[model samples]
Target: MTLPGLDLPALQPWFTAAVPGSGELRAELVHGGRSNLTYRLTDGTDTWVLRRPPLGALNPSAHDMGREYRVVAALAGTDVPVAPAVARCDDPAVLGVPFTVVGWVDGRVVRTADELDTLSAAEVQRCAFGLVEVLGRLHAVDPAAIGLADYGRAQGYLGRQIRRWNDQWARIATRDLPDIDTLHARLARTCPPEAGASIVHGDFRIDNTILDPADPGIVRALVDWEMATLGDPLADLGLHLAYADPAFDPVLGGKAAATSPRMPGREALARHYATATGRDPDALVEGLAFYVGLGYFKAAVIAEGIHARHVRGESVGRGYELVGGAVAPLAAAGIAALDGSG
Candidate 1:
């Protein structure tokens, strides 16, 4: 099917001109993601996935499509189940912004347990274990080997990130949400020690992956590299725990489905990651809190940004209202977790 909201006639010549072994590029929208634009492009005999920064995005460092391409390309021959990268176009003249193309991988991205209930228990375990193991491997990789040694600030990553998002909230603050600022201040004061620099998937949740049903737990392709970065590895683990934890507020935007209720939970996932990476989870709690709070704080800012975009007549839909509402509570939860209440 032809992709919606894309001008194929305008994009075709560019694809043919830059990428080889392609003819008659076709497009299709991949749904349910808000940060970046994703599309499946095919050329009758060849297929690829394209990702680019959102239209009119103000966060230049936040959405570096070229970095996504370079990082995924560097991991091409590794055991990580990343989609094979084809090419990247950094020139603004092509497709309005920088974009990268990777060969499409096949799998299902399950967001609810009903989807998993159909599968056998063993299969479910495989998917869960695979997710944990892959994360451990990701954390173990040396950034210098992949030409990403300078991906982020070499020191005080946590401190810099905390201040960055807090400033973002300050800039866009139109209402009196004391919780956001309170959390920021507390986290800044209790900033955890640097937990050794390594590659961290800023947002490492199950929804960002594609799982093969036949293999159940094994990820066929890990998607969404827009938030990938070089930072404290425990930060990635904490973000995973934040999303995997069973304590999220109920009624998640009328999705009305429990996606991770029985999937070994966050503690078990952490142990699995620890065992795989030979790291001690007990020693990483402080760092984890810092990262987890950062993750939630970042999520709130992103939701606010989306709300702002919606008010300006963007492509966002009403379903995002619930996402916007999650900001305050999630920020509060992060603070509590940092305060040793969670």
Candidate 2:
């Protein structure tokens, strides 16, 4: 019998041909990130990471494996530590969908409070500051220098983000969420001008990156490029702060993967980013409400979508059952962020 989404018997030939001396392919799905399906593939001596859209229906732009490959490929020699891209397989006839493979990076993803506690206080501080520094470095990169000038429309990014998420809310909303509408209207009214364009990671935080297993403070590679695009850099910062909200823990079943108590405070993170980038912290703080509102709105919409899939019995996973309960809380958080209270 063939594996669920992969046909190893057929793929072994293609993989071996593309990557010489491969043998006895084996794959196990990597469970992290919300948008794309990822798997770790191994052939005894070597390992590779494969990424593709989740099985069944998917939002095309949200899971663009080719775009992920292209951006990561373009970042080959950049200061950003990314898993090196190996090859792209765009023919669905072979694997039922396009998939990208990258050299497997050896590292650990620290998420829980206990995990952070294990590291000395100094190490914990280092990991926390390291994350913000890396994010600042990413925002400082010039897209054209990396050949990603046309990655996405940089102008009017905030408006586009609002519209895009609002559309998603309409498609999968299971019930009425008045606060969602309230937050949307508020965010639209206060939408700030674009904060200059850069390569936005879409979802940036600690767990999204892999740390050196030995050193913990050093970042080996930044994974999960499903939502990567050229957009306002502040959007990434906002989302980073939003994810830090305790409300997000519900989506991950309480012990959220990136909530190590040792991590720097949200205010500290913003301050660090501002200092590193020479941006005015006061301006960033002033717009925090809008960005944070956008952040919570996006989270609520994504949770609703996952709940929609679960309702259809199309998605089965540990956190799927709990996602529906998260929307209301996130909506409240969004309003609070806008109110300068969250």
Q: What is the C-alpha RMSD, rounded to one decimal, of candidate 1? A: 2.6
* Model 2 TM-score on a 0 to 1 scale: 0.95
Compose the digit string of candidate 2's lDDT tens values, residues 186-284. Answer: 899989898788998987877889999888779999888888899988888888888877677756556664655557777888888898889898777
Model 2 lDDT at residue 183: 88
Q: Which stretches of candidate 2 lie above 4 Å from their native place?
A: 1-3
Rate residue 187 of model 2 by lDDT: 90
Q: Which ten residues in a row have the lowest lDDT in candidate 2?
A: 252-261
| TM-score, per-candidate, Cα-based | 0.90, 0.95
Number of the top-ranking candidate, with lDDT as the measure: 2
List, residue by residue over 174-202, the lDDT tens digit for candidate 1. Answer: 46688888888887898877777888777
How many angstroms is residue 305 displaced in model 2 relative to the true structure, after the best TM-score fit? 1.4
lDDT values, one for every candidate? 0.72, 0.82
